[model samples]
Target chain A: MKKLINKPENFVDEMIEGIILAHPDMVRTPGEDKRIMVRADAPRKDRVGIVTGGGSGHLPLFKGYVGAGLCSAVAIGNVFSSPSSDQIFQATKAVDGGAGVLYLYGNYGGDVFNFDLAADLAELEDIETLTVLGRDDVASQPKERSADRRGVAGIIFAYKAAGAAAERGDSLKEVAAAAEDIIENTATMGIGLSPTILPTTGKASFDLPDGEMEIGIGIHGEPGIHRGALETADEVAERLMRPLVEDLGLSSGDRIAVLVNGMGATPLEELYVLYRKVHRIAEELGLTVEKRYVGEYATSLEMAGASLSLLKLDDERLALLNAPASSPFFREG
Target chain B: MKKLINKPENFVDEMIEGIILAHPDMVRTPGEDKRIMVRADAPRKDRVGIVTGGGSGHLPLFKGYVGAGLCSAVAIGNVFSSPSSDQIFQATKAVDGGAGVLYLYGNYGGDVFNFDLAADLAELEDIETLTVLGRDDVASQPKERSADRRGVAGIIFAYKAAGAAAERGDSLKEVAAAAEDIIENTATMGIGLSPTILPTTGKASFDLPDGEMEIGIGIHGEPGIHRGALETADEVAERLMRPLVEDLGLSSGDRIAVLVNGMGATPLEELYVLYRKVHRIAEELGLTVEKRYVGEYATSLEMAGASLSLLKLDDERLALLNAPASSPFFREG
Candidate 1:
C-alpha cells in the first residue's frame, strides 16, 4: 500500500481540489462538493453543452478533457463507481445553455443507468438532453453484439469529434449524432500485464502471475478473453490489433486514426514500441493511418498494460479529429 | 520483474524506433544508428542549436522535449546510462546552424565527461559550443555546494527557459546563460515509495519495503536522507518543500514556478493531491505562483514516487517559462 497519499478516504476530494487549484484557468467546480468540474467558461449560449462522467482513477479522461473545444463539464465519482444521478444532473444544469446538453460517456451499466436517470431529471427541468454511449472495446463483445461491448480508449475520439462539433455551435442532436458516429466506427482492445492496486484496500484488484498477461482485460480488472505467457512487443501489438481491425472491418483502402494508450503503469517508451508494430501492421494491411496518438489517454490506476484503438474515419470525422483542440491531457495540430 | 518489454538489449533501440515512427513530423533519426533524434525542422539557420540527452528509460525527458521552440536534438542512451560521445557529436553536427550549439543536460559524471568530449570534437570541426549543467536536486547536496548536487526534474525548467531563449534567436552564450540562470534559481526533492524494476536485469534497482518511503531518493535509486514509514501527503509535501525553500532562499513576495512531477508509476490524481498542499504552502509563505505544472515531467522508469521543483522567477525568466512551446511530451500557451 505504498502511495503518496495521506488518507485513502479523502483521495477523490483532494484530487479534485488539486485539479481546481492547479488549473484555475482551465477548470472549476461550481458547487462546494467538488464532484463536478466544468470548464471555466461554461454555459456558452448557443453551443451544445457536452458533458461526460465516470468513476475516478482514469485521469485526463473525464476531467482532463473539460476545456475549450472539449467537454463542457464532467461528473466525477468514486474509484470504479458511477457518480450519483444527482451529481450528473448538477453537471448538466451547470453547463446547459439554450441549445441543450449531450451526455457522453462509456457504456458501463452503472454509468448508463445513472446518466439515464439524470437525463430524466434534467428533462423535468425543461432541459433537452440526449445520450450517445461509447462501446468500442472489441474484446468485450462480438461484432454482432458490439453494442454490448465496453468503451475504452476509443471514447477519446468521440470527445474530440463531438466536442469539436459542439464548439462549432452545433445543436445537441447534431453533437449526439456525431458522437454516435464515432462510437460506431471506433474499436479498442487492451492487454493487461499487471493488476492495479485499489487505493482503499491497498491491495491488487486481481491476481496476475508474473511473466503472464491478460489479453482484453477491462479497465476495472475484469477477466479478459485469455491469460497466457507474456509475448514480445510485436506479438502483443498484433494480438491486440487483430480484434480491433476485425471488429472495425478495416481493409487496405480504409483510412483510420490509431491510438496506442498506456494503462497507467506502462511506460511511454513501451507504448511507442507497440505503436511501431501497430503502424507496420496497418501499412501491411493497406490501411492508411491519418493520425497517430501514442501515450496514456485513459488509464487504470497503476495498471501495467496498453490498449490499442482504431477509429475508422470519414471526411467529417477526420476534419473534426484534425481540428484545433487543447486540453490538459490532450492536444492536436 | 513484470515489464512489457521484449529484450533488455533491444529496449533502447526499439523505443527510439517507436518514438521516431509515432512522431515522424516532430522528430527523426538522422543516421542509421537511431541513437540521435533531431527535430524534423532542425538546423534552422541563425538559431542557436540546443541539445539534451540521457538514459533511455525516461521517456519525454530528453527525447519527448525535442521540437520547435525546444531542444533541437537529443542523443539516446540505454536505461540510466549516458550515451557515447560519438552519438553526442553526431547530434551536434546535425542540429548546428550557423550559430553555435548549446549542450544542456543534467549533472552526472558520465554525461559530463562524454558531453565535454563531444564538445571538443565539435570544436575541431570549427563549431563553437557551450555547456550548461543542471544541478537542482536539493536533497543531493548542501546549499554551499549546490553545483555538486544531482540534477533531477528541475532540468525541465532549464530546457523550457533555455529552449525559449534559443528559439527567439538568442546567441549560444545567451542561451547557455539563461539555462544557467534557471539551474541556479531552481531546487527539487523527491520521495520514493516503491522501487522500479530494471527491464534488462528483471530486478528492482533498490529494495523499498511495504508501508515505507525513502525521502530524497535519486532518480536512479541513489540513497536518500532517510527511510521510514510513509507520511501523509501534507506532511510529505511539507518536508519536501522545506529543503527546497531553504536551498532557494525563498521568502515573502517571491514569485516562482512550481512543478509537481511524478516518478513514473504515481498517478496524476495523486500528483494533484500533492500539488494542492504545495499550493497552500506557497501561499502561506507569501510566495506567488506565477506558473504551475503538475504531471510526469521527468520519471524514473516505473518507480512510484513524486518530485517537487520550484524555480524562482525573474521577469525575463518568467516570460521565457510562459513562452509558447510544443513538444511531443510538453506544450504551453
Candidate 2:
C-alpha cells in the first residue's frame, strides 16, 4: 500500500497527537484520554456547549469543527467506526458550561446509539443534554422518510448555525432548535469516481471497475442510488443539484448557501469545474446563491469524487454564517 | 480517463469562471480579459501593488493569494504553462497604485521569460515593476548553486511576507526585498508516491513503480535526489526534516515556521501523522516551531505525495506571518 502511515493501529492516536501539537492555541485534549478534544477555552460559564463526535478519517468534519464558535468539543473514533459512549460522555463533561450541552453529529446507527448513551450518562450528573442528528443526504432515503437519510457534508450548516447560537449565550433548547432547523433545510448528494482505502485493513473501502462511477455514495462507502459509467462535470452537477433544490422546495426567490466539496483525491481545479456548472444551474433556476464554499470540507480518505450541498437560507442562517469564527482548518467572517 | 471535465481545453477557463462566480465579493476581472484577476479593491492609493502568476494547476499558489493583505492580482495560464506577457502586463497595470508594482512568482523558465517580457511592457507604459523569483527547492541544486534551484511550495513564504510589506504602503523596493529575504531563508523538499495525470494529455506526469517513492521530487515531476521503496511516515518525515533543518543552518536558539503541504491526493490525516514526527524532531533539536501551517498550499493536480518547508523565522518574519490576510483559499490572523 502507498499510505504514508506507520503501524495501522496507531493511525488515529498519532493523528490526534499531531493535531494537539500543531494547534495548541485552538484545541487541546480535555483530559488524560487524548481521544476527546475540546476548544482550549472551553467550558465558558453561562454558555450552552456544543459537542460533536464521529469516526476518524473525515478531517474538518467531526474534530475540525471544534472551536470557539463551532463545536466546543469532539469525541474521536477509529477510521469509519463510532466513538465509544464513555468517550462521548467525556467530551460532554469537558465542554459543559452551567447552561447545558447539545449533542450534534451525523445520523448513523452506531453514532446515534453512542451519543444517546452519552446523553443518558450526562443526565446522571445533572447535566441537561439534547440530541440533534444531521440528516441531509437526500439519496439515502425518500423525502417521506427524510429522518432516515444519512448526513454528509451538509452537517457543516448545522454546525455553523447552531454554534453561532451557542456562542451568543443561547439556551440549550434554542441551540437544539437552531440545529434542527438547519438540518431540516439542508440537502446533499455525492458522486464517487474511486473508493477510499482503509489504513487498518490496507484495503479499498469499496470496489468498482476502473472507469465506472457511483452516484449518491455515503462517506463510509455505503451503496448509493446509481452505479454506472462516469459522467461529465456538468452532468454530475445537474444530477446532484436538481434533487437538492427539489428536496428543499426551493423556489425562484430563494436564497441559498452552496458547498461544492471534494471527497479526497479530486483536484480543487475539478471542484471549481463542478461549482461552475452548479452556479449556472442555480441561476437558471432563478435561485440566488448568497454564500458558496468550494473546497475539501468533508472527505473519505483518498476517495476521488465530489459532493454538492445546498442549504435553503433565510436572514438568520445567513447572519450566522457570516459571524467571525476561527479554527485550525476553517475560518469565517 | 475519469476526470470530471467536459473538454480538456475548457478546463482553465471553466475553473476561472467558477472562481469569479463563487467569490465575486473578494475578486474580479480587472478588464475584458477574464484571464487576469485582481483583488476586489485593487489600486489602493500609494500602496505597493503585488502581482503574481504561474501555470494553472497550482491553485492558491499563484492566484489564490490575491486578496486583502496578500497579492493584489494574478495572471493565469493553462495547466503547467506560463501566462502570456500581455496578461502579466495587464495585471501589473491593474494593481499599480501611485507607488509601484512587485512581480512575485515561482522560479520556472517559462514564467521567468514571460514576467521579464511583461516588465519591459510595464516600463514602456510608465509602470515601475520589480521582480523577485522564489527559488527555495533545495533538492534542485546544491548550496553553491542555490540561485538556480526550482521554486516549490516555499514560495508561499515570500508571498506572505512581501504581500504584508506592500499592504502597509512600503515602497516597491522594500516589498521585493522582503520577498527576497524570505526566499533566501526558506528551504523545501518533496516526496512523490505516484504521478499526477494531466487533463490535456490524459497521461501520468512521471512513471514510478507501485511501492516506490521519489524523494526530493519537484512539483512538476522533475528529477529528484533519490527513489526507493516507500518508507514509513516517521522515516519519510525524518528524511525530509533533517535536510531542511541543516540547509537553514538552524541551531538550538532558532525559531522556525513549519509547513507540511499536501501535493493533492494525500489525506490530511497522513499529513498530521507526518507533522507529529516533524514536531518531535524540532523539539529534539531545540528548535522552536513558533508558527505552523499544514494543508494543501501548493499542489500538482492529483499527485499522491507531500512536501515539507521550513522558514527560519526572526521577529519580523513571524510578525508578517501573523498579520491578518484573507483570500479565497487562505486566511491568517
Structural similarity to truth (TM-score) of each candidate: 0.99, 0.99
lDDT of 2 by residue, A233-262 (tens): 999998999999999999898999999999
Position B162, candidate 2: lDDT: 89
lDDT of 1 at B8: 77
Q: Tens digits of per-residue lDDT for model 1 on B1-333?
A: 667677778888888877777777888888887989898988899999998998877777889899877899999688999999999999999998989999999999999999999999999999999999989988888888987999888899999998899999899999999999999999999999999888888899999998899999999998989899999999999989988898889999999999999988888888999999999999999999989999888888889999999999899999998888888888876
- In candidate 2, residue A67 scores what lDDT? 89
Flag clash pairs in model 2: none
Task: Say which docking band candidate 1 falls in.
Answer: medium
- Docking quality (DockQ) for each candidate: 0.78, 0.82
Top-scoring candidate (DockQ): 2
Highest TM-score, which number?
A: 2
Alpha carbon lDDT of each predicted model: 0.90, 0.92
Report the CAPRI category for model 2: high
